[model samples]
Target: MARIDTNVKSIRYPVPCDEKLTLLARKLKRTKRQLFIEMVDYFYRSKKDPADMNDEMLKSDLSRIGNRLVGFFRTQESELLVPIHGMAQELVGNTETVKDELKSIHEKQGDAEKLLRENTKHASEQIRLLTSIFDGLAKMEEMRAGFRRIMEGYIAEREALGWSTSSGKKDELVRRFRLKVDRL
Candidate 1:
């Protein structure tokens, strides 16, 4: 069996006997045990050798880390943020130009549609006029045919009655009718 010291029986360690550790605990207004625990925890968490660290060395190391962080942030701003900001501005400009062109195209399309409607209306009117003109010509041709049929009937009756087909009075009357028809 192993023999354990009286102090080590409960805490598993002997109390420190350093004069500086005692003075530092007094100055820091903490118990010697608390100070020792805090020092051990700090060295363990920081992964730094307590024998190699002092106030000046810690400050220099912190300053170097701060400078490296600042330099990294600056590089990121130049490489990524600057180009992204420029692309955003260019996208805004291009969008405005495209919107203006689309608006112009829409206006031109509206004007073309209006012109097409007007042309269609005009064509319809012309078709109506042409239809009326053709109807008038057909009615005139019918009247001319009826007048010829009546004249032929009259000539046939006179010929069957053994009357002369041409006479001076008839020729004068025909000449007067031709003049009236020409005037009409």
Candidate 2:
């Protein structure tokens, strides 16, 4: 039972037996104010209330616990302390080892991530180069086809004007077309 309220109302009372209270307070090494507080707490605690069964049971249980209580620290060199201390030290060592392993793993992961990024960049560059090369080859093929069509048109017009479509004339036409393409 504790009262911790700061906003206490002032109380003043005259006790009928002042000499006895003063003597008792002196013998108990308490101030008159403290004696008053103790008297109030005792009076309320000893007051019988049929509704408060929990307090009676708590008192009975608390008395039993007090009677059975033992103190291990009352003796020197306890048997439990050495094993507990050894276990704690072993756990500390294991924790340090785990920390070291975790640090190594973290470093390796960083290196692996860096390597992956570099590989990705290199792969992307290679893909870009390959794509450009393919595009140039495709454009060259298309230009060759266009040139062939233009040469056919020229040969057809020459044939309509009575020029021979013999192998000799075909060789001449091919040579001229190649010369023109090389110049361009």
Query: Best-fitting candidate, measured by lDDT?
Result: 1
Candidate 2 per-residue lDDT over residues 98-173, each given as its tens digit: 9999999999999999999999999999999999999999998988887887678767756764655677767777
TM-score of each: 0.55, 0.51
TM for candidate 2 is 0.51
Candidate 2 Cα RMSD after full superposition onto the native fold (Å):
13.7
lDDT (tens digit, per residue) of candidate 1 on 1-184: 9987655523444445567777899999999788988998997887776666565667889999999999999999999999999999999999999999999999999999999999999999999999999999998897787667656765665566454646875665567556645644
Candidate 1: stretches off by over 4 Å: 1-45, 48-66, 164-184
Evaluated at residue 129, the lDDT of candidate 1 is 100
In model 2, what are the clashing residue pairs, if there are any?
A: none
Each prediction's Cα RMSD? 9.0, 13.7
lDDT of 2 at 27: 99
